[model samples]
Target: MLVSTLLERLQSDPGRPRLTWYGDDGERIELSGAVLANWVAKTTNLLVEEYDVQPGSMVGVNLPVHWRTVTWALASWRVGATVVLLDGAPEDPAAGNLDVVVTDSPDSWTGSSADLVVVSLPMLARRYDGDLPPGAVDAAAAVMTYADQIIYAPEPDPGRPALTGSGVAGAAGNAVVGHDELVPEAGPEEGVRTLVDGRGRAADVLRQLLRVWAAAGSVVLTGPATAAALEADTARRDRLVATEKIERIA
Candidate 1:
């Protein structure tokens, strides 16, 4: 299935912490399997019901490595939209054909013809306080109104591109990976605990998330490469390891 089993597998243990995000801005957001699934479901419903996104639609994500970006990616995948990692500037063919775009900075994409969703960076923000351009959606404000449970869409074409615009060098210059290659079959529920590097490219982060969750694992995602790099700050690393009970770093 093009839709990942990670979210579905999370249902078995709703209370278990599935994703833990430590923001560089001193925000710590933790979501259990149930909570993460709910966010993804709500965002998924919002995309299809409000924006008409479905299978084969290209959804652009031009955001930094954070918890909200993760939710957006999972939601787009659930709705069968191909996720194009814009990272603010996309020099790819797929970027020009996006059906919808989700971005932290709406001003950059305000002129684009594609449907725009301006997401707030803060997790507690129920609305993006900043002014959005005409036709741009206030995702944070509207998301709360969406259904907690997802109204599942039809299965997407597994052979179609699942992710693109990755930094990996290629003939097309946009690193693309198919759904059949990206989404894995459900693996054992070992509930492995690992630390995910949030400093990497969006594609790399997404790939690591898929792998960790496939084993019914939990992840403590470190913030972007900040003043205290994960490698240099042995104290922070040791603290995170001890506090989060990290079994390994991915």
Candidate 2:
């Protein structure tokens, strides 16, 4: 229900910029609300149709703080699946009790005795070309084949578990935040453009990005930054806000 509400709000303003991501290799990607919703829909369909991931399924996301990570989280929540954020490969994969594990590193999960879905993390959302790890599903390839719109028989329950961290300290869902209070940050007047330090924890970065979108703001994220790049970014945009553990400049 919370995922549906967020998608509906995003659909209301399809043309607005919701995410703008920059990779360490200098690749840049900008996605509108509609585009993001489409990705989420396809991902949800992939989970439901391919993996049979139904409500209450535990979906592990072993990925960095990237745009696709956000899409995967939203898709899992859309189908009422509990999202488990993993910083890296699980020490004992079976010990996590995950129904499905999605990761950019297929090799890491190949030996894990659990079902694995591999994400290429391509800049253009392209599928991997060569041979994949044994018994691993190509998420980008599978997701593209799904419908862009999702139609559930019975809508997902809002009170169900939505998100959990690798540890027990990071469990939360619509029940914790409530439907009306999705994000607590102040809404940006025009739009927010912030520089996020991707080196931080993936869950923290994800929560911050969601907060920015809830405030109707766009993000300009990067993995670590050089002084020159930071200066250039600050000079180019008057509303740019830089977020780093050392110092946050607005």
**Best lDDT goes to which candidate?**
1
Which 10 consecutive residues of model 1 have the lowest summed lDDT? Answer: 166-175
Clashes of each: 0, 0
Question: lDDT value for candidate 1?
Answer: 0.81
Worst 10 residues of 2 by lDDT: 241-250
lDDT string, candidate 2, 68-165, tens digits: 88899888877777777776676843227788888887776766666788887876656876668777888877888889888552245666666666
Clashing pairs in 1: none
Q: Rate the local accuracy (lDDT) of all candidates.
A: 0.81, 0.68
The TM-scores of all predictions, comma-separated, are 0.91, 0.79
Task: Give the CA lDDT, 0 to 100, for residue 80 in model 1.
Answer: 67
After superposing all C-alphas onto the true structure, candidate 1 shows an RMSD in angstroms of 2.6
